[model samples]
Target: MRYTSEHKQATRQRIIEAAGRRFKQDGIDGSGVATLMKDAGLTNGAFYAHFASKDDLVANVVADQLREQRASFDSTPSGRAGVEEFVRRYLSVEHRDSPESGCPSAALLDEIVRCTQATKEAFTDGALGVIDEISAGLAPGDPQSVRAQVIAAFALMIGTLQLARALADQQLADQILEQGVQNTLALLPAEDRG
Candidate 1:
């Protein structure tokens, strides 16, 4: 039987959502097509009807996840206060422990570096959009310098989350998260009081 266009789009959305979680939890290279199909409640034979290959899915999934993330941050205020809220929430223990729903950059960046050029480009575009959003919180100053600061903070966030997730000791993990929150707050451009 042939599927309707709505059915096809729904199937594609299901595949992408499951792939994002699987990629975060198991790494893109680690997740098998069979497993991804199973997670999506579809048959192995049906996989090709949606995505051309795993690389295509990887590129699309990263773009989708990061786009959703950027939208989530849109409501946050733009200033030192905004960056502090971002740091606290992003570096929290809960965020560190939940790779499935957490930032794709922290969970899959290492793996993304080795993906096809199309996937790499998707990741880069997503990451840059996030950095631009965070840069909005920086104080008025040289655009170049403020942007540099926000980009560095974004790096520190991804790195700290990755490191905390890798550590075995919870105490040390909490410290790692807290230190990132503390340090990033300090580096944020102070609000003008005049």
Candidate 2:
């Protein structure tokens, strides 16, 4: 029987959501096509009906993740303490340990570095949008300078979280998160500056 458009769209969304989770949990390259299908509650053969290739799915997932990131960036308050809370939460041990449900930037950093142009473009665009959001939270300054500081904050947050997650020592990992939070908070504009 032919499926309805709504059914197809729902199924497609299921595949994208499942694939996004898997891609974040395991690097995109590490997640097999069959596993993605299974996770989406469909057989491997049905994959082609939705996505042309895993790369296509990756692009879709990256786009979706970017939308989510944008919402998060826009919703978060621009106050100094709000920025502190963001840094603390972002660099927390919970965020560090939960790649599957955590920040896509940190979760997919390695695979993204060598990804296709489509993937890179989508990622870059989303990231720049987020950087703009970050800039909004900073004290009023030259746009270029604010963007530069925002970029540094982002680099430190993702890099520190990645390293913290990679370490075998739990204490050191926790310490990394704490230090990362502190450092990230320091990157933000102070109340006096704000």
Candidate 3:
């Protein structure tokens, strides 16, 4: 039985969503195609029907995850308040504890740096879109001027979350998250801190 285009698209989306969660939880290299398929409630053979290769799926997942992250940013009030909210949420205990549902950059940046060219390009494009969204909120007057600052702040946020998640000490981890939020917020200009 042939599936309709919509069915195919929906199935593809399901696979991407499942893969995104698995990849974030269990790095891209750690997640086998069979496991990813199983996560999506499909057989290993069904993988090729949706993706040319695992690399292809990785690229798709990265793009999809980043788009979801971007949407969260879009939902916030557009200005310093939005950036503040973003920093707080990003460095929170909830986000730190939930790698599968949290920011892709925080969960997968290390792996992303080693992915295939296509996957890297997908990450680059998606990351740029996310950066642009945050930059606009940081500097509605001239986002370009604060683009570097935004990028630095975002990197700090990603790194801080990663470190917090890696620590065996719960108290240190919580401290990291608190300090991460403050340090990230400091990157913003005083004028934009409103």
Candidate 4:
């Protein structure tokens, strides 16, 4: 029987959502299309019906993840509160350990750089949008300075999470998160900084 448009859309969404989780948790290359399909309770043969290739699904998943990240950041208040809240939530050991719910930038940075043009474009747009949001949270200042600050903050956030996850000891992980946050806050200007 032919499937309705709504059914097709829902099936496509399920595939994207499953791929997103798998991509974040197991890196793009770590999980195969068959495994992803099985995780979504679908068959590998049905995959092509929704996506032309795994790369296409990867791009879609990246876009979905970016939207989720944007929504999370947008919900937080701007200025110091927003920065503080972001750091607190993002740098925690839980965030470091839980790839499924954590930031996709850190999870897929390497794969993103190597992905197809469409995937790269999606990543670039998502990253720029994030930078713009972070910059807006800063006080009125030199445009260049705001841009630099946003870049620095983004680097710190992702780097700290990576480092925290790398360490063997829980205490070391906690230290990395705490010190990283303190150091990052110090980098901000006295008045407008978080």
Candidate 5:
């Protein structure tokens, strides 16, 4: 029997959500279509009905995950305080320990570097949207003026989290997280440093 359009859309969303979590937990190359389908509680044969290929799913997941991240930042108080809150939370031990629910860029950047052009483009768009959100927080009146600072600071946060996760020592990881928060906040304008 044919599924309703609503059912089809819901199934597609389910697949994307599962793929997002699985991809972050296990690198994209580590996650096969069969495993991803199983994670979504759907049969492997049902994969094609929603996505054309693994590349398509990866691109969709990248966009969805980053969009969610941006929206989350949007919920915080605006201005310098918002940016600081984001940095602290992003580089926190909780975020460090939970790769599956953390930033997609931190979890999948290495794998994303080798993904298809379509996937890369999706990442680019999503990343820019996230940057824009942070930039707005830095400069509510003129985000473009502070765009460079936001990009650099955000990059540091992603890298710091990635490095912290790679290390086996939890104490060192926590130290790195603390330093990351300080350094990232320093990148902001002196006037906004408060």
Candidate 6:
């Protein structure tokens, strides 16, 4: 039986969503095409029907996940309000433990650097969008200063989560998360405080 166009689209979407979650949780190298297809409730033979290759799927998934991240930030309040909220949620223990729902930077930074040029470009575009939003929230200042701060904030966020996850001791994890949050919050401009 031949599948309808809608059915094929839905199947393809399912595969993309599954791949996004797996890629975030397991990294690009960790998720194989066979396992990804199986996880999506489809067989290996069906994989090529939707995606030309794993790289195609990976690029699409990266773009999709980045778009989701951008949407999340956009929905939040603008200016300092959004930054504070973002810092609070991003540095939480919950965010550290939940790789599937967390930022892709912390989950797949290494793999992203190694992906195809298309995938790298998608990641870069997504990251820049997020940084732009954050930069907009900063106080009026030199563009260079704002850019530097934005980079620092991004690094702090990803590094904190990474360290929290790596630490075997629960107390240490909590310490890393809390201290990271405090430090990040401290970096915000005094005028931005609310």
Candidate 6 regions with alpha-carbon error over 4 angstroms: 1-7, 138-145, 192-194
Best by lDDT: 5
Q: Residue 137: error of model 5 in Å?
A: 1.6
TM for every model, in the order presented, reads 0.91, 0.89, 0.96, 0.89, 0.97, 0.87
lDDT of 2 by residue, 60-177 (tens): 8887887787677656666566567677878887888788887889999788878888989889988888777666666545445566767898899999999998999999999988
Of 1 and 2, the candidate ranking higher by TM-score: 1
Residue 111 of model 1 has an lDDT of 94
Question: Mind giving the per-residue lDDT tens digits that candidate 1 earns over 1-194?
Answer: 99999999999999999999999999998999999999999899999998899999999999999988888787777666666777898999999989998899999999988999999999889988887777654543444556777788888899999999999999999999999988776666666211
- Residue-wise C-alpha lDDT for candidate 4, range 1-194, written one tens digit per residue: 99999999999999888888889888999989999999899999999999999999988888888878877887887776786777788887788889887788888887888999999988878877777776667654443557777678788888888878778998988999999888777766545633
RMSD (CA, Å), candidate 5 to true, equals: 1.6
Q: Can you rank all candidates by TM-score, best first?
A: 5, 3, 1, 2, 4, 6
Give the whole-model CA lDDT for all candidates, comma-separated.
0.86, 0.82, 0.90, 0.82, 0.93, 0.83
**In order, what is each prediction's RMSD in angstroms?**
2.3, 2.2, 1.4, 2.4, 1.6, 2.8
Model 2 scores a TM of: 0.89
Give lDDT tens digits, candidate 3, residues 92-167: 9999999999999989999988989988898999889998889888787788888898889988999999999999
Single out the weakest 10-residue window by summed lDDT for candidate 6. Answer: 136-145
- TM value for model 4: 0.89
Q: Write the per-residue lDDT of candidate 6 for residues 79-128, one digit (tens) a residue.
A: 67778888889989889889987788888887888889999998889888
Scored by TM-score, the top model is 5
Off by over 4 Å in 2: 139-145, 192-194
Alpha-carbon deviation at 145 in model 4, angstroms? 5.6
lDDT of 2 at 119: 88
